[model samples]
Target: MSGNTGYAEIATFFRRQIADGTLAPGDSMPTQKQVRQQFGASITTVNRAFQMLKAEGLTAARVGQGTTVAERPRVAATATARLRRISRTGRAYGPKERSVDHQARLLSCADPDVAAELDIELHDEVLVRSRVYMKGNVRTIASFSFINPRGWAAVPESLSPEPLERFWQEDYKERTGRTTVKLPERRGARLAYPYELAMLKVDAPPNAAVPVLVLLNTWHDEDGPLEHWQDVFAPGLWDSDEE
Candidate 1:
């Protein structure tokens, strides 16, 4: 881990160890000197590896505390479970979690991403729902659901705080004269902004931001896109496959 890719290599080594439970939460990471000696890397290179882990919210560092694996809630619920529940019962969280708070309202579509996904013009009024899901006292994820234009008229319940299953079908058939299809989704990850971290109640010590998982789901039909939902999952949400 000492050449041009030393930083990335060292980072991935520790990342894998953490993922597989070789490094448990609250367990101290090897000191920078130890890492540099083991990897034959420069001090700067070793620091970069630690920085990557910190930014990802996988570890924490302090003057006396050094660096330790960050403690995280072990909620067994998966994203697929929540999606299935939403499709069947319109609930945001699966059986393993619960909605702690929810807010819903109609507003002009100010987000360009949402407009592109829903194939709608900017400034068009649409339904927006914000929710925070929790497992026991710990937050599991924070989500924002944007209902496309069709659901506004046909499924007025989209404006309510309550979750609605198949909110697009009644309107899809009326507009396209056909049944709706499946919900297309995409997942990604990026460093969370300061405000978002506060909203999700995350702490990223020694760094300004933490990593987050993003889920973008679309409910569309043969005619075109109908409704788009963006779910922002909080840090430390364990994916069984990844583990």
Candidate 2:
């Protein structure tokens, strides 16, 4: 009661409890009302706490089932921890741990499939971003991003090293002067190719003959498509990373 009670703080407390196994996996947590009552906090404060836990994948809620503890999330080490789990588990993840290399070149857009997904109008302006990623001196990944000209019209000169979601959140607020930032609803991806392999400078092993990861990303506004982009990165490059 005397300690911090902010949304992030409450969330952090719940996360530690879950991580330490004090709150076992699959266990139901107090309802929003109950938490508020127990902590002498506002309902919004309690909800924020739950949202924090949800953000970290430490809790779940159902319309009729109320709220419950989520299964423990596996912790990993690297640039992006959640991404590491996503690479291994294929779950939705946020973009973090990525840094822009000032020396990288921006490429022209070419892939027809990428444009189709974005629903870009014929001859419409678009932004194509390409970069080759390296870990120290070793080339590790290549990324290509396609953005609708209008959607990214306010594209900044740079992006933060934070995860993509957080970056989008901050960027949208900056570009539109609005707090609401609509992100992509669906995403698709695939493995890399021989050309991709050469870009990464890593030899593809027998089973790893494929490039690495060929990713398709799309963003949408309330009205419609904002972006459809593709990225290629070395396989297992994200395996050991985390947020």
- Report the number of the highest-lDDT candidate: 1
Per residue, candidate 1 scores C-alpha lDDT tens digits across 75-181 of 43344545544554444443335675677888998878898888889988888888777755778667777777666676666677875554445654766576765
TM-score of every prediction relative to native? 0.57, 0.44
lDDT of 2 by residue, 1-243 (tens): 523367766676566555444565677887777677666777788877888778766678867777887642232222233333454444332222234442222334456666676676455556655556553354555665566655455654423222343343257557776543334333334666666676666676745646344444565665456655455656665322223
RMSD over all Cα atoms, model 1: 11.6
| RMSD list, candidates in order | 11.6, 11.4
The lDDT for every candidate, in the order shown, is: 0.70, 0.53
